[model samples]
Target: MEKVIKSSDRVKDHGEVFTPKRIVNLMLDQPEIQSKINDLQATFFEPSAGEGAFLVELLKRKLKVAKNKSVSAKLFNTKSLLALSTLYGIELLEDNVEMLVMNMITTFNIEYSNIIQEKFGGKVNQHVFDSAKVIIQANMVQGNTLEKITSDGSPIIFSEWKPVSGNKVQRTEYTFESIINQSGPTGTVQGATEEMDLFADTDFFADLQKKEPRMKKYALCGWTSIYKQEIV
Candidate 1:
């Protein structure tokens, strides 16, 4: 039998309890939820993703859809990554977050290898694996979901990967809070103005101009190369 609780201390402190596989399947079996699982691009976010049990099952279903829609190795690679990109999660405990990432990566790689052997009859693509790693790492983050911030108090950021054309994707970053508030991306911006020199020969009025925060967008790149962040 699977161990659902790690320890009594964890249970008391964080209420950490893993859902049983049977229960997870039954819950996901509902008609409306199963319909979304069949969509290769439908995004799913688990606010309390302990060890990623739900996300893993979701990935498995999406991978099946990807396989059904693919007729070649290249098409399989593209669709499988697209499926991987749609699953996101947040785990409060660091240990659970580590396990969550591991489980997700393992499940995805195993499915990839299986498809390659059964359908493609060739070596699995390393680029595809690397890209999946990038997606999993970005989508699954260790944070307090209710607070919308990471353990260190910084805002949690998630990347949005949009397939633009062919195998190319456009990447955009959005803070968890911004996403919840429907505001916008909290992008990399220049630091606040340097300490006012009061005595330095400077254009006082020019120095007073507020530095607008610029939102940066990654240039469109092949889905297999998303690990490299190239700004536009």
Candidate 2:
């Protein structure tokens, strides 16, 4: 005969899961938000990006706006694709981060490729491929929210990221150069040069404030829920 287990002996699980797309839409579609869209610079931060559902929708909306305005196809195409530059996300789980990154790349590639074909008559080369790759990679960053620190020193953000499973915690610093290096010389080709200057500036705090003076005095903690949690 088997004995029944007591409630005290059982552990409750609160598994991390992706946010539903419908819920994400509702949050983004609030009337107050709709009115503020034009005045705002379009930058977005998702503390828990889980599979990038919200990001994908945001991109679609930006693209629609560009297309409807009769903007130059080249400028609109680049702008639509560059909208990814406004996105930022963090995931606690490595697997989840990888999944989100892959999805982001695939989604952006589909739109970017279509734009290229429509504009350039089916041209396929390193420039187009590299541009698409750069946009996708820039939008998604993989790191634990708990282990990051904001520009200000109020509270430590992303301080809980752990790459290894052990008693001692290890921190990993990732840079654009590191990632490009790992790509193993695939980016270098005669007449296929791409500037690395864009990746050199990783300080979002300075870049954002410079573009919009209203954002100058805003604390870094106000930018995302993760930092808000840290300050509180």
Candidate 3:
């Protein structure tokens, strides 16, 4: 099953678009992220939560920690998972959002099932699954990060934090339009005023408040830098 899913043509074509699992694991394994997980106040956000790969892994790790610590069945209980809504994700594509929700539900089902079976000797509970499905559905949102608007005019807000370095986190907000235009068919015009103009808006600066409070706005064009020996 794993091989089939991993080898699917759609998976092969779109896999590169997803963050590599190894990289996700490494990032989550970082001491800073580990400490953040221990800090219940920390919220996780993935702006480009393609199919929710990172979210699933993070949940699994959290569940493992809860179990290992014997943190009471109530602490790791189904209700707790529902409240474990600290993780948030945004996907620009509606279809991808749907897929992400399904993936998250599946991940929850597997994790919950394991917990129930291990703790309660497989006394199945349909209510748990139903409740988890609802929670997962509610957590994933479909919207553009750049526009901060949904398919409808509703505002898009995510509670997740994109981890940066120690004691720092950034809210993941990519100006989808800006990214698309910058890399689009324009043929990479080194330093264009229009590109710079996009970064100068007050709205963009406001959005950066929680994520990149100190991030400096910069214009980008094609540039080459040579290192001492190896070209960079």
lDDT of each: 0.85, 0.46, 0.54
Minimal lDDT window, size 10, model 1: 187-196
Give the alpha carbon lDDT tens digit for every residue of 121-215 in model 1: 86798989998998999899999999776786556788898988778898888877668878766643213344446576987755544222234
Predicted structure with the largest lDDT when compared to the true one: 1
State model 1's lDDT.
Answer: 0.85
Give the CA lDDT, 0 to 100, for residue 131 in model 2.
Answer: 45
**Predicted candidate 3 versus true structure: per-residue lDDT over 125-223, tens digit per residue:** 565566456446545778766665566534443322233343222323233333335543222222322333455545765443323212122222111
Model 3 regions lying over 4 Å from their true place: 1-16, 69-75, 120-124, 157-232
- Residue pairs with colliding backbones in model 3 are 44-160, 44-161, 45-160, 45-161, 171-211
Per-model TM-score on C-alpha atoms: 0.86, 0.50, 0.56
For residues 1-232, what per-residue lDDT tens digits would candidate 2 score against the true structure? 2222223323132145445677768977987655534322356667767667787777656555544542454444444433544566765555666778787767666765665467545443444345445445534556544534222211111111221232112222232222324532222221112311346656655544332212111112211111122221
Candidate 1, residue 78: lDDT? 87
In model 3, what lDDT does residue 141 have? Answer: 75
